[model samples]
Target chain A: MFIADCQARLAFDLLAHTWNPVLLWTLRHGPARPADLRRRVGGISPKVLTETLRRLEHHGLVTHRRYREAPPRVEYELTALGRTLLPAIEALGDWAHTHGDDVLAAQDRAR
Target chain B: MFIADCQARLAFDLLAHTWNPVLLWTLRHGPARPADLRRRVGGISPKVLTETLRRLEHHGLVTHRRYREAPPRVEYELTALGRTLLPAIEALGDWAHTHGDDVLAAQDRAR
Candidate 1:
């Protein structure tokens, strides 16, 4: 049997990083060059974006592809396994949309 | 309409904390005292567990209750809204189960 704590903790660790889900969600549509990703995901620095992409690629969630040319074109896309996480991410988004206000309010009170 | 980027980012923020989901998942069964939580979620310090519980309560995901006994008793339980997060968290867990090895392997390669 899958250990609930270990399995669940694994998922938590995966989703716990700020940029991981955002990058994954950003690529939900399809592959894109770094320039396009930077444009699409505003507020992220190029350096940070590069690091996040590398992590994602390292995790097998995204692939790094290079197109040969004078100025080599490179792009990133979510792998099939990575695609499976879209729905899971969406479920989280749905929860946030429905109840994020309460959380914000609570945070406000705490502060 | 919920902006996909903003909505998705909100979810990421909520789930991005290492202990948030773990604490939330720990209370899946029912209410528990801090001692029980610390026991169930091994490796977490009492201080950190308390902090996590406070955050979850602040987020309106968990409720704090106190008993009117001699020493006084305090316990935590998931609210109705908090329970909603179970499936979402589970969805993430499912993804981890299927592909977490790939992520681990990739991390090892990067190391």
Candidate 2:
């Protein structure tokens, strides 16, 4: 049993946003520039992506580095803390892969 | 990499709600009446608890049974499908226990 303000609830809050886990998962492979991230992630506007990145950075799950190159490259990478969450995310993914249809079927039955 | 509408996303959506996982966890022990759940869970309004239970039932993660006794009694229990999610929830809980302080520190640093 967990209290409403428990630390576990904090972790859940971090994942409550739709894009947070998605962006973290996207960054799992390695660092990538925002443009590359946009192309890879798909359907996210530049504005929302930037906002989400800042949010992740604020939470210390991600960090950014800027290169003083011709076009000024900026790459986002997961911090060690961020990497720690990957397995849990993968676990959720596995559960979805296995039981997603059941959940959908349940939804249909309710409807 | 998950697409916007991936099944994995569906699983994340289920966990995105704050009380969903908490209530699911509370009922993990066994069938519990609504009043008992309220006392165990704490701080949740009877209305919100009712709504969350209905949501979980609609998702097929939980089921309810009614007894015709001196006073009618209703108990909520997790379905087999719901039981399957316990590991994933426990995994999240473990992560929180191990790394929750780090996350909080990060938040403090950001502030």
Candidate 3:
């Protein structure tokens, strides 16, 4: 049990990334095409956004559904597993809302 | 309001990283010296562990207090803001516990 818990913890760390919050938060608002995700998830480059989405989709945290329209739209949305992770994301947001100043202060002290 | 939220969201992204979870999880168990952290956070090299702890300390998520006796000792603990983020971490753990299988299945399908 302990070993399993440790491995689970490690897996969670593997999923944590610089762009994850943006990817998840953007999806939290609603489903979006890859291009739209690039725009909505500001500060992310096209390459990085593409890579992030692929990782998220690969992990089943996000699903990609393609449309056979003229330009070929690809929409990304959280799957049931992805949705299951929402509370963690939302909880993060709540932490930021409440303690952002302290975090900023700590950053300032470090500099 | 929206823009501030966006920046805050961005900052949160900046904080998320592969080693950050391990660092935080190590501290979650309790305060420890850098050496101890390296041991507890499996698969992390000393260099990465050192860098991660510095970043955590810089961000005020963790603090370092040094003692000068014999071999010397330094302890790291989460700040109030860091403690404030615990619920989110615990929530992530809870999410993994409940939905780990689905997440894994999603990963398998992607392959």
Candidate 4:
């Protein structure tokens, strides 16, 4: 077990935020405009999405590109550093896919 | 990316709590009495540790055994279901070990 201040806790802190991994996974497909991201990701408010993206960007997990088109299109994409986290996220996703029912059942038994 | 209500979100929810993963990891070594847990875990208030343990018990990730000898003792250990999450947690830990400095650098740059 890692100590409370171990560097590994940093990964937990990154994943602890409700939306960070979600947005990171969403951006894995390719660069996406904010509106497109909102649509694809679903249920997240524009404000929260923006905040999440800014947080990801601040951590250098993601980067944004502004296309100076007629209306100034902007898009977000994962950085190489950001791409490194995909396997970890996918591992958790795979676990959930297989055992989510078990967890739900456990929860049900508890209630 | 997974939809907001996807099963994968369950894993994220499990990990989102700051101390859940920490406690889970601690229990991975073996069963320990609550007091031993408090001493080894360090800095966690007794109340929060109890709450986190109960939450893990409720989720079927952990089980407790009570011994009625001497002063009476209870030991907590991870369930089979709980053990399944170790690899996923380890994956994140490994990632952090490798890339935590990068994240710190990014945060520093953002500042």
lDDT of each: 0.80, 0.89, 0.70, 0.91
Native-referenced TM-scores of chain A, all candidate models: 0.90, 0.95, 0.84, 0.96
How would you encode candidate 1's per-residue C-alpha lDDT over A1-111 as one tens digit per residue? 123357567767777777788788889989899998887777788999898888787777899789999799998999887787888888888888877777777678768
The residue ranges of model 1 lying beyond 4 angstroms of the native Cα positions read A1-5, B1-5, B109-111
Q: Cα deviation of A71 in candidate 2 (Å)? A: 2.1
Model 4 chain B worst lDDT run, 10 consecutive residues = B36-45
iRMS, all models? 2.8, 1.1, 3.3, 0.9
Pairs that clash in candidate 2: none
Show pairs that collide, candidate 1: none
Native contact fraction per model:
0.62, 0.70, 0.44, 0.83
Top TM-score hit? 4
Sort the predicted structures by lDDT, highest score first: 4, 2, 1, 3
DockQ of 2: 0.77
> Listing every candidate in turn, what is its Cα RMSD in Å to the true structure after a full C-alpha superposition?
2.4, 1.3, 3.0, 1.2
lDDT of 4: 0.91
> B1-111 in candidate 4: lDDT tens per residue?
488888888899998887888888888889999998888777789999999999999889999999999999999999999999999999998999999999999999999
Candidate that scores best on lDDT: 4
lDDT of 2 at B42: 73
lDDT at position B60, candidate 1:
78
Give a tens-digit lDDT track for model 4, residues A89-108: 99999999989999999999
Better of 2 and 3 by DockQ: 2
